[model samples]
Target chain A: MNDTNYTPSVAYLGPEASFTHIAAAELFGHKGLTPRPTIPDCIEAVTEGHVAYAVVPLENALEGSVPLTIDYLFHGGELFITAEISTPIGQHLMVNKAQKDFTDQLESIQSHPHALAQCHKFLQYRYRKIPLIQTTSTAAAAKYISEQPALHIAAIGNQLAAETYGLHIVEENIHDFHFNHTRFVVLSLRKEILDHKNHAASKKTTLMVKLPEDDKAGMLHQILSVFSWRRLNLSKIESRPLKTGLGHYFFIIDVNESEDHPMMKGAMEELAALGCTARSFGSYYVYETDPSSE
Target chain B: MNDTNYTPSVAYLGPEASFTHIAAAELFGHKGLTPRPTIPDCIEAVTEGHVAYAVVPLENALEGSVPLTIDYLFHGGELFITAEISTPIGQHLMVNKAQKDFTDQLESIQSHPHALAQCHKFLQYRYRKIPLIQTTSTAAAAKYISEQPALHIAAIGNQLAAETYGLHIVEENIHDFHFNHTRFVVLSLRKEILDHKNHAASKKTTLMVKLPEDDKAGMLHQILSVFSWRRLNLSKIESRPLKTGLGHYFFIIDVNESEDHPMMKGAMEELAALGCTARSFGSYYVYETDPSSE
Candidate 1:
């Protein structure tokens, strides 16, 4: 499986035609792709040596971070992020081909909770009386709608789902905000991928830091002071529970520099001196989806 | 509707027996409690004057922040946090009474995604081949299992759900971790509740701040410096996208001081001087659920 002649297999969170699937396609092209039912399954596939790589959503511009992905990476196991991909999210109203007048025949809409929330204004204004059913994923909802023979049912999902499930797009771009985007990370058990020259050229490092048990006044500020004094730019900062009890959290920071950078190294050493444990996941380049390719 | 003789109505996110319902009951004690079908619906019920107060989950001990609640509070409307409640979460595996041997007869387990994830270890070890179905809520799953006459179906939910739906608890405490808890906030449009003596003595304030259009290095550090210099303790800090674009975000900080405190007032003024806009939600005491009362 480690031979260069072997076809590399990639896993993603999917029921097919999911946003994660689109991100995986953007990164791997038409190579061997496997769709896993959940985030954990996708990562497990990589850890268990069934796949060479796994792609999972890290955060969304509109909805914030994906909790499952972050929690698993922080506490569940040790998997390094090899690369990053950012894709623009476009949600559409999909229905069976027999449904012509959606407004008149639309009895209920089915979709993932996030998709329904993203199209809040459109749903409230048009189908105020109808109910909204929750599904595991937008792609799952599209598959369900395609399998049904009802005219009053529809789903809110991406264009890829409509195409894959043989549904017709009744309306396009129904999301409340036009600038929705999701960031996905490529995870792999192989350390060689992180040491690749192409990945090293991109100066971005993500670190997970856990502060001292005694959280005194100005403790967080002290940790931030290390990076502030060095003038290292931080692109994002998020906190997740340690799961020990209430009020216990660990911080994840994305810095605009590589792990080997002198400033980042100094900051990490200073943080360790201040009773903080910091671990660098990896340094990787982010690839933006090209509109022309889509 | 605002008369003294009127019995105020309260709303919670529910199809009944939800965690939000339990929080609402602990606060209102069965006084005019109404169950809203969704988080947005519960908030809208209060905003439209249909209900006097709404109870919604803010964060979980294991799952971190509830993105829907945070996003709605940040961008949806003008509701303010009047009070806070913390409830212990206890999950149970429930089955219909007719099913005596669930280990052999169980074909599917239905639950909300969070509930399913929390009970991952139990499900995987005991019934590896059973299909897990996703529902809108844990309470909804319990209701569905109760209504069906099939012995092959089961649900993972709270004890209240088991009792409410007349199901038998096959196993208790099925969650992966023991210390599971969720923080709920009481939202209201009325200002008189915040002026009460009990709420004024809590001395905890939550502030939402939006940085200037140009995000520069060390800007967040400067904002934290205002509180650090005064020796004010900070409980939590979270960032959410401003919906403007991919790189823009606004910060939400929880300070261990009242909004009217001189130190907090000075911090807000200094933050404003540094090109940031801050709004105080409120100061209130947190009530922990009493096991004996339940």
Candidate 2:
């Protein structure tokens, strides 16, 4: 009876109807899609062979890096980033269908703090005195509001959340900033899991470089110089705690080049020789998903 | 009636006993201390001439940069960092004095999300099934627990929070990492606010640099090269979003040099000519506070 081979199993950070779910559904078409409660759980599903791949939010255009995802990728068991899904995040002010007309009676506005913060201006102008409640996730907040009908509570989440939880969207694009997008990465146990469509807009190679412990001064500068002199254009560079101690950090550099490129390889080798532990996270395609399609 | 002119006025992010308050008291003592609800409020207190100085957290060892403080420094207003205070962060598990002996009855565990996350291991091992709640701050949680006695609620915060709120420390140093430190900055409208103690370990000059929008490639490397070739030691380098759009960033670099130093001045001039808009945040001394004294 355990013979579901036609569809590839995929996991995403979710409680269902989360942005991650939207991203996973956009990529995998909702077949064999499982929702894990946390980023680690999503990664674990892939590592344990429970799912062929996992999709987790790596960064938000507004919030910057998702530290949990970065930390897990750095310390957790081996997993490769196969693809990046960039989805335009549209935060919606939603309420239970029964209480949609009674929004003025809203005593509380509930959402993940990030979502609440993203739509802070709108909330401040519209419901100034409403108490804000923080939930584990936007989807979780939506689910809670749906379960407790006519409670005069509103949740700020995505369109998918409103649809999934049977809530009515009172306002769309309620985020303070319009250029909001969340980058979700597809993680796999194998090095490369190419998309069948392969209609990627761009390619990037991400590297984790830990500087030499003793060589204190200009070590980071030297590492960057190697990449610079080689003419490798860096799209992003972030430093996460090494977790060993304070002031110890490992740089995550996203180079706009493929992993197999000569300049990228040269930079990695030069960085290694400089007593820096440089490792390739992966060379992956970035797919900008059109929110309209979903 | 208001003739108390002996103490200098200072503001901090607080309900009275938050970590920012501790840092403020450690630097300025208790006299003329004002507690502001948020980071922006604390900064506004300084900028609006409500206080001589405002103490705010800038970065944490485990968590990295405090985005609010960074953002305010970049865009909020013109405030100079007068001094840097490095405090040892000790997260203690506390609860109402009435429920000190009945930790097993705890139905909920609460703290700021960062504090809660820091004590994740301890919470998992001991209060595995306890529902975790997020408050605005650890001190706020402690304050809430104090007001609602015997509610089977526990809070994770510093020692000061426990004492201030009349709670008992059930577990001390519950944070998983031992070497945790939070760097707090003293912000003032004036360029300098020297401590009477005249004891500082080192001096650092922080510069905010924004690359020319069009000159994309190798711009960051060139900026680093300016400091690297000059042999100026860098303690910290962080990139905050310009907020203009995605992928646009402005860097904050801390150099181990005085602002007046010849080489440092030369580097700043070179950066200016390189088509980068560079501004001096401040050149200030760093103070390592003794937790034992507190």
Q: For this target, which candidate reaches the highest TM-score against the unseen true structure? A: 1
Clashing pairs in 2: none
Residues B1-294 of candidate 1: C-alpha lDDT, one tens digit per residue = 224465568998776888888877876766688887556777778988998999888876222226667877778658888888778888889988777465477889998766777777788789889999877678889999888866689999887788899998888888776555677888998743433222224557788989898869888888889899999988888777777777788988889887878988899899999999898888777777765443
Model 2 spans > 4 angstroms off: A1-25, A28-57, A60-65, A95-113, A120-155, A168-170, A194-199, B1-17, B30-56, B60-65, B98-113, B124-137, B140-154, B188-190, B194-199
Question: Residue A102 CA error for candidate 2 (Å)?
Answer: 5.4
Instruction: Indicate the residue-level lDDT of B46 in model 1.
Output: 91
Model 1 ranges off by over 4 Å: A1-6, A61-65, A101-103, A192-202, A291-294, B1-7, B61-65, B192-201, B291-294
DockQ of each: 0.47, 0.32
RMSD of each: 3.5, 4.4
Tens-digit lDDT track of model 1 for A153-177: 9999987899898888888888776
